[model samples]
Target: MVLNMQPMRTDSTIPRIVICGNLEFASAECESLFKGVAEVLVMNSLSSADLIEGMQPGGRYEGAVGILRQWNGFSHMQRAFIEALPSSVKYISSLGAGYDMIDIDACKEKGIIVAHTPGVGNDATAVTALYLIISALRRFSVAERQLRAGLFDASRVTQGRRDPTVRTLAILGLGGIGLRLAELVHAFPMRVVYHNRRPFVGAPEWCEYYGPGRLDEMLAMADVLSVHVPLRKDTVGLVDEAMIRKLKKGAVLINTARGKVVDEEAMIRALEDEHLSAVGLDVFPDEPTVNPRLLELPNATLLPHLGSISSDAQKLMEVRGLTNLRDLVLGLNVADLVPECR
Candidate 1:
């Protein structure tokens, strides 16, 4: 396929932008940063066909339409969405990272420019996951809750002869964030081991590689277990009751990946029964709201999905999305343009 490698030109007429998914967030970025370059259409829900049908009236977007969406869990309608769009929709930019949910090959077949914001949230999310691992291992959530509920001597329950600095850590799915976390974990001289779908090339010397079979074995030996895998059919619910049961007694669990990849109910039970020491979750099966049982338990450190919230990351995301869309409209070359599924 021929790739558009030209640069962007703002001299063209005002383009139209259709904001799908969360409009409030996109509008905030566009109104504040994008200015008068494009016509913005903010809609909460527009069916795949409806979106394309709307653009067909003029046979194409007024100039070029930029389609923006968030990392909402996977949707099968993606193929339909991409196929329906007239070759006129020049660019599809995901607001956050992880474009796995979108069909890239389909976009590529149509020469639609596809780009995702990567490395933007790497540091923020890596730091968040590391914090979660530490909090879970030390049972910080339990103490915080106990003290807030007018209970004294919360330390007895939280700091009961536990030292995370001395325990081993096993990371599942060593992507950018996982590697960053590994670097941080090494500072404490902790034993760090990881299992990835494929062996990572040029991994840091501090990380010991383990094949898939070793994953179960590693879990049984680790005191802190962190998950960093992307959500896919093969990986969804990768860890269930059986896997949790394999972990060392009082082992801590941390998940920064998609919530659906884990069985939330099972995790809660493991924490309550003390089969697992504690859990720090930054994402949930249902986001913006989570299971009430998790909130009621002190053994869980639940973050409101702020793993990617940082000034630098947010600005980078805005700039990448804006630049990608601008380049596609101007028929310029965009870096990291993902194609759609065949």
Candidate 2:
């Protein structure tokens, strides 16, 4: 597959760009950015089936300049969309920080240019993870619910049992969010350790990198474990019964990354058995829908994928993503094009 790095020709046939998902928030900014250089096609999730027509022979996808995904719901359809696109589409960009929902391997195989905003939501997610850690450590969620339900008692909130010293933190897949979280948590002077597939380059002075063999060792020590890895074959269901059993009793688990990364059913069992203390999740195995049992647990705090929903991060993602797309469209090298992950 030949990759086009040169700027698309201007006054050349207008490059057709199709967008999948709702465009309520970003359509204006994106339209203003692309302006005269490209023709934009916007489709709601229901209309995506028509977009697929372009993917087939004699399809409308031929000669498309780009495809931009606003919402990450089309994982099952993404491959087909890419497959149907005419070979001329040079770039594909997602609207948010995480691109784990997209089948990047398929895009790469076709030599389609793929890019996503990273670090745009780093602080947002890091802050959310920190909140979960604190909520779990202090059992804030239970107390809040009790109060909201008018079952509140001063004694429970004041005398709730939690030993800060006994709580150890083990971060899985310590990327940008994990690293920032490590720094933020240190103000509490908490014990911090992390596990990554490869050794992190220039890890903070306070962090100790535990190799894979020592993952179990770290898990057993952790009273709180946070996950920050992307969803992939090796990562999906990375946390299972065996791994959950190793956690110290009353351990809290926080996942701000992909939901599929953790085995939801196994986590529920751990929580029910009291083997695990609490689990807080901002992402789920099946997004937009989560395990009903997880919601029933008093110890569990679940969020509707709010990690990167901050207004600031959203704006940054739009500006940065569009700038990259425009630069690439205008025949300039993108500085942060997703590098081939080793």
Q: Judged by lDDT, which candidate is best?
A: 2
Candidate 2 segments whose C-alpha is farther than 4 A from its true place: 1-12, 22-32, 44-46, 53-62, 72-76, 154-166, 339-342
lDDT of 2 by residue, 1-342 (tens): 111122223344767666665544454677678788776555433455676666556654546677766554355435765576567777877666667666677778777777778888899899999888888777888888888888867527665457555356899888899998887888877788999878788788678788978998899888789998887678789888888888888888999998888898899999999888788889888877888898888888878989987878777776777767776677677765666521
Candidate 2 lDDT score relative to the true structure: 0.75
Q: After superposition, how far is residue 144 of candidate 1 from its true place, in Å?
A: 1.9
Q: Candidate 2: give the clashing pairs.
A: 7-331, 54-60, 55-84, 259-284
What lDDT does each candidate get?
A: 0.72, 0.75
Candidate 1 local lDDT, residue 257: 82
Let me know the TM-score candidate 1 reaches against the reference structure: 0.79
Residue 70 in model 1: lDDT: 44
Model 1 bad stretches (over 4 Å): 1-15, 18-63, 70-87, 100-111, 155-161, 339-342
Poorest 10 consecutive residues by lDDT, candidate 1? 1-10
> Using TM-score as the measure, which candidate wins?
2
